[model samples]
Target: MDYKDLRKEYLKHRLDPASLHADPMIQFKLWFDEALQAKVDEPNAMVCASVSAEGKPSSRYVLLKELKEDQFIFFTNYHSRKGIELFETKFCSLVFYWRELERQIRIEGIAEKCSAAYSDEYFNSRPHGSKLSSIVSPQSSKIESKEYLESELKRISGMDASEIKRPEHWGGIGIRANYIEFWQGRQDRFHDRVCYTKTESGAWEISLLAP
Candidate 1:
């Protein structure tokens, strides 16, 4: 199969500033609502990108837990590579790709750890097994075998739910976006790219880019 032939057919939507909400967050909410209505699988999933102090880039899939006026929130282990990188540099990027809609959202921003109280609130809302897993696994760490993890999980499984707490190394990070770009696929590779950036005066300026 020719890899280049795997082109997207994007008759589903088009993005124009005139049709967009004045606030990017509002636009995001519109798209998110559409995704939900379409019943796309794992619609909350997004790609998070981080760069280390030494300039090494890493990215992974993470669930988008919340979206606030100025920031997007997700949880992670503070000691993980991405977490540590964000700690040091306080910057990251997130990408949401919904193939069913042939659309993507890219955001770049500064990251900061969310309040511990906020972490606890979300932690307590997780399933029992998920809470135990968060407490048991040292995320991104090298372990001996699956049995080691299973045993640890089993040990904690018997504990009372009230005894469970958010791990000290686990919490949430919120990315306050300085730039956001929305992409819509088009026929013959004539994709559309629209960008919104925050200016020094704390207002969003929108523009189009060649794609």
Candidate 2:
């Protein structure tokens, strides 16, 4: 197979500044809803990027747990790479791509820990195995082998679900976006791009960008 010969031409949609919502969060929810309606797989999954105090960058996929008050929420172990990095830098970015819709959304902003009550509410709503995995698996930690994780899960198996508390090291964080960009695929690679940035006065300014 000739790798260079493979290509995809985007013709799914077009995005214009005039058609966007004044609030980027509202726009995001609209797109997100469309994605869900279109039956996109894991539509809430997004790429989370963070930088460490040493300026090292990290990226991974995390599921969006909630969106409210212009904030996007996700959960993870407080000791995970992303959590530690956010703790040190107080900033992060997330990218959502719905290939079926030929669209992508990028967000950048400050990240802060959610209230413990909110975290607890969300954690309690998770499936039993997900809660157990968080309790047993040391996310982002170097372990000897996969067997160690399996053994740890086994160790927690006998415990009652109600008795298993949300680990102190695991919880939720919310990204309060300062900048948001929406991209839509166009024919011949002239993709459409629009960016919205928050101003000091709490208003958003929208701009069109070159593809």
Candidate 3:
């Protein structure tokens, strides 16, 4: 199969800077609500890009667990590669795509560890199986075999949910955005992008970018 020519034209909607909310987070919530209304599959799924101290980059998909104040939140094992990378460089970029809506959201920000209390609260609310898996697996670590992981899972399966506590190495991280860009695909690939930058006085400066 030939690979170089693959492409799709975006014929969805136009994004206008003047119509966006003054607060980027509020604007984000509004777009997110539309994604939900459009019934986009896994709408909360987002790609998080992190850079190592050596300038190498890694990207992966993580579900957006929560959005609070001016931040976007997600959870994972603190020992994971992304976690360690963020520990070294306290920042990351997030990309959220709602294909059905032909829209995308990009965020750049500082990632901070959320309060232990908040992590515990969300951890407790997770489904029982997810709670068990978090306890059984050492995320991003090499394992001898799949059997070993299954055995560990089996070993912990009998434990009551109340007895299983959120592991010390697992928790939530929140990203307080410094910049956000919203992209809406338009006819003939003439997409519209509106970027919001945080001003020194705590205001947002919105701009339209040539697409």
Comparing 1 with 3 on lDDT, the higher-scoring candidate is 3
- Which tens-of-lDDT digit does each residue in 137-171 have in candidate 1? 88888888889999989888999988898998898
Ranking by lDDT: 2, 3, 1
Alpha-carbon runs more than 4 Å astray in model 2: none
Give me the overall lDDT of model 1: 0.90
Q: What is the per-residue lDDT of model 3 for residues 59-154, given as tens digits with 9 covering 90 to 100?
A: 999999899988899999989999999878988999999999999999999999998999999999999999989988888999888898899899
The lDDT values for all models are 0.90, 0.92, 0.92
lDDT of 1 at 200: 100
Position 143, candidate 1: lDDT: 80
How large an RMSD does model 2 have?
1.1
RMSD of each: 1.1, 1.1, 1.1
TM-score of each: 0.96, 0.96, 0.96
Tens-place lDDT digits, model 2, residues 1-211 = 9999999999877886788889899999899999989999999999999999999999999999899787899999999989999989988999999999999999999998999999999999999999999999888999889998898899898898879899988999999999999999999989999999999998999999999
Q: In model 2, what lDDT does residue 138 have?
A: 83
Candidate 3 residues lying further than 4 Å off, grouped into runs, are none
Which is the winner by lDDT between candidate 2 and candidate 3?
2
